[model samples]
Target chain A: MPRVPADSQTSAGFDSNLLAFTRELRAEGVAAGTAELLDAAAAIGHVQWSDRAAVHGALSATLAKSPEDLRIFEVVFERFFFRKAEETALQRGEEVAGKDPGGEQAQRIDLEALKQQIATALQEGGEGSLRDMARLAVAAFGQTQGGSGVVGVDVQRIRRSLGLRSEPQPDLPPEDARAEGVPRDRLREFEREVRRELERQTIERTRSLPPARPLGDLQRGLPTGQAADLAEIHKVVAQLRRKLATSGQLLKGQRQSSAIDVRRTVRASLQTGGVPVVLHQRPKRPKRPEIFVLCDVSTSVTSASIFFLAVLHALHDSFRKMRSFVFIERISEVTELFDRERDFKKISRAITSDAGVADVSGYTDYGRVWLEFLKLIESELHPRATVIVLGDARTNGRPAREDLFGQIAARAGRTFWLNPEPKLYWNYGDSVIDSYSEYCTTFECWTAAQLGDFVDALANPRHLPPSK
Target chain B: MSNTPKTAEELASRLTADGYLADTQTALVAWLAIKLGKPVLVEGPAGVGKTELAKSLSRVLDRDLIRLQCYEGLDEAKALYEWNYRKQLLRIQAESADSGWDKVQDDIFGEEFLLERPLLEAITSEEPVVLLVDEIDKTDQEFEAMLLELLSDFQVSIPELGTMTSRSHPVVLLTSNNSRELTEALKRRCLYLWIDYPEAEHELAIIRLKTPDLPAAVASRLIELVAEIRGLDLKKPPSIAESIDWARALLLLGADDIDAKVFRETMSVIVKHRSDLDTVAERVGVKLDGGDAASAS
Candidate 1:
């Protein structure tokens, strides 16, 4: 007989494991269906079983639908394969018991003190470290299924201590006997009671505690765009820049250079008789594309606009030239200020620093802004340049001049509108996004994630980046 | 060639013979695709050597490399199979001049008038062929549908002929730069492999294989500079093919070391974008000129 399970050692083991893992993945909102799972299973035959990276690659190829799915698969794969039951068992063995043996008969396991430790950890450590400690607390005192801190084992000792059943259950304490001899079950009861009490107290404490400042993934779920903290916006810009814009020299790879210089190569071949010893290639890089940024700095979408400009400013090396304009009721150029400033901290102030360009505060008339700009600087706009507009598209019932926007879009290479408001508000109220979206590639970007998608699309405009 | 490594350990060895190296996963996938008679869909960003894998497979397999380079508006007539209409017209004229038009007209739609494209050519070839449908994402959805059918059946249907099946069906490989999202139906039909930029050690192996004559220090410096540039924000990034080309360019210049002067003169070899060149000159140039170590961050 094999020491491990029959399925674990064989290729059949991997197949079942893959199926079960895909099921978990589907439960987690990844759209991995039956056919995808089967494809993933088939892929395992080609890759080395011992090589987890190879297995990951094979599964990612079969299971993942897009680059987003691939990222999810990486996380799911670690949760499924790397964090298995055996490792969890080893971890359980390593966990220290919470009971103090020095005190006579362990002094009924301090529930209040345990709750205090948890509250302090929750306050001091981040969510990641807190979750780890919570899992450890559960493991050491409470009975849990395994390593994953998601669910704890049924609170058997707690139910026993409280005496939930009216009659004496088999192998359980007699209902009346709890009135006499409840002392025998106290050690086990101590473990279970502390976990339950700690959990309840921890929840109450965290609710009273202020929300963490540097928003973790816990706070990333909401679609709060402009409302996000300034530091969070900086984090988002740096992240999006890395993921979407920063093109690596060793990444976007090579192409077959067109039309080898045969005359030059052949002439050089004369050094080794008629055979071409060396081939010469005159490879040329493709011409850089231009981006024209038009930002609206009204009071409403100021934060979003600042981040948009900050990210674009930071990524100026990617394009040939990026001419920036800030508009309130009229437009004016701020390229010189951005050209001088590389620090993002300084950029936030510099964007809204000059009150003159932003028309010195008034009702945001977008039509007037477009009319004023088109009349003065239409010559600067080129067919090869993409104009990106950052606004909420709330025109305050002013004349939107959608046709003027359309004409500008027609003359330029391409047009994109990034509205800071959630897409649910696109056609609602005074949002003229409905009228404007028809003329350009318009989308809602209320968060860094959305902005990342937008930036990715801008970098490679051949296709829209699919939602992660 | 006779002594080519047959096992997994030898896969790297065998592929290295051509100055191209494959990681264990890619090697395993290639071996499996050949053994299992399944099409392998390779997808990645541009310049990661997706097409080079096909060439390497063709070389390793000792088969004719049939490539159907995909583009927009690529229809079945160009991709899979098309009838030889011109040849048919000539034959019709010749047959009518000699025999009656009745027999010639019936035979005009036969296999004699059939013109086999890459897919059909690979299917009908006696020896196993390595069929490369390069840049499938560039083509439209209709071409993908045709590929789905052809890939699944391993044969093509013709009105003139019933169906031509091969005794030895070709090993199919489809590559995409992921410019456009391919349909799920197409991805499900094949084994998948994504080729990324190799790690430092993996890339060094490839560099050594491609430019065997280069000094070790120079190779290290070239890779080091590329890694540094990769960290910078730029428009178009250099790929593996570019690294090889850059290495070749440096060798031609006969530069003994990577210093400010050599890098200043030949910076364009690696940096393709004008803006990126400017950034590199400003960032990397200052370090090199400061009389600091060449490998300064």
Candidate 2:
């Protein structure tokens, strides 16, 4: 609860004060959603007007998610909502020197001057008894500030001057005979009444402040910027690459000296008097498979693409030569986008644009993209390449061009088709996944987790033999 | 009196005296897994006491911890046992003159030539071991599939050796940061728990416990302020470990109060990032001049 502005108002009786308080909560990074706000209002509505503790408890329960949320709510609520009379005095500018007489003016400045005189007297050291000091401080603060006077001294400050750190000393006699020139008992009664009223008013002002809303209720589904998630994706990928590099795999482009055929080495050693000797050996090169990736960049598959790009970036080091293309209503070759520092947004934007071969339209034309892909394959497909096509296979019920995919499958080492949509959505609408499934070595890629698994299988093909 | 306590300290103490290390909830979970005969899967933000729970549990329970750290490309051979090809080759070469191929093949692929990794070691150990599979979310699905049978039955299978069942049932604790949602099969095999940052009072108690020499006032103020910052929507919130660090920093500097000057000088104790510190400094509006007694109070 923060101090709300006096003039603020809301349709739900959430006046300027409440709005300002909620604003401060938001600024403090609490999730302060509309639902939590409505809940706070409901809780506040149920509480009795006089029971401050019940109101505070209700508001806390409505808003707080955890103990940490409660603690923060308490501090912020106190700072923002509690309106101390001392602050009221500061607003008046009466007690300090060079005071401003603007806005609201205090009625009696003489009482503040007298209180200052007594405080000065006490600071001058030992001139007055403790009773004398208490009398002077209270009379000056209470009389001047208490009545209808605008400019009155702070009684809490007077109590503080009387060596009372918190509340006034409980054991103090209420009488001040020397200063008031009255009977001790009578003076005591008057002083007690004034002290009680002052204490009551102070409590009323501070306790009337609203309770803070719980941070957890406010924080649910709060939008985290895309940059943060992207950075996290980057970090995870880098860590993955580092772990892979350390697993005794050769760094890309670093060739091994030779592959020692165990049988041949042993046979040569036996021929050379059973002693292992230098033997000429030709280097054995592991097959470097070419990979072609096609990704769907439709709005529905955007979340899936984020993970798809991360896996593609990670596998760049392992693959011999990789070509990537993304399509929605068009087919485009984005092999150059596989460079180490390519911007993801730029690639996504480029793939969805009309600058590519197939015409840009609202829905994918699988037949058009497939025909274009076939043309490129006939001209540029390497004998050792693996073709990977990723999409939901929705083409608005047009021709699926399954024959082109089948022909491409025949030329490549292996073909994989990945779909971000669930398997249940495969046969619906314009999706031709069922038709294209026959040509693919594997046709599965539903979640980001599955996408990563599929990419790893492609990059590290030693685990699985090449499909016929 | 009713038994439920409001404060974490009271709960922690009660749990501790019940023959459990109470403050470390993550470790308590791992210990409970052994008692309950269930695998524990703990998930939360990083540095919120996920992996440390496993480490602490190993110490508290007096069991050897077999740690299998998961990564993107971790496979069965890396997690379980792999055939020692070099050792097998040496054996084959040594036996070539005297032994036939059949005897040589049998000797090379024998259990003696198998190199046990973390998973295999946990399953084979005679003494009860705590197997900590750290950050399972980082690994691919295939690797996760490999752990499903092992985690559920406490057994691992090799093509040559068939299946190896646990000699002494190892208490399994798997941790993830939720980088990706785990397959339901893996989640179903374990008892799930989510560990969060401790409350302010609990953090204060932890500070006092870990750094006893610190002034009570300083620790209290540090806990209060750090608790305030955690309420903010920063990229990274300070963890409980950081609260202890901040208290120690204040004790070293001989400061008793939390003022703007001390806060600026020792901001690093609570805030690890520059941007987060800047945000905290702007939000905490009180100024201290080493003379503002009222403000300090």
Listed in order, the DockQ scores are 0.13, 0.02
| Residue range B231-267, candidate 1, lDDT tens digits | 5555666777778888888888887788887787788
TM-score, chain A, per candidate? Answer: 0.49, 0.45
> Cα lDDT of all candidates, in order?
0.67, 0.60
**TM-score of every prediction relative to native:** 0.54, 0.39
Which pairs clash (backbone N, Cα, C closer than 3 Å) in model 1? A249-B238, A253-B47, A254-B47
Kindly report which residue stretches of model 1 are placed more than 4 angstroms away from their true locations once superposed: A1-13, A28-31, A46-51, A86-446, A449-468, B1-9, B97-102, B290-297
- Whose TM-score is greatest here? 1
User: What would the DockQ be for model 1?
Assistant: 0.13
Task: Give the per-residue lDDT of model 2 (tens digit) for A1-468.
Answer: 532222334324443445576667766665565544544554454444355554455445444433344556665665553443334554675353212221122334355454444434433334233234444444455544453321112332344333322112234344421232222223333333333344334433444423333443212211111444556556666666665454334433465465667666677899788776856564554455678887666544555666566556665655547777776666776666667446554544455454363454456777777777888666677667888886778777678889987888878768888776555456755677778878775545643345456646655665443544
Which CAPRI level is candidate 2?
Answer: incorrect
True contacts kept of each: 0.29, 0.00
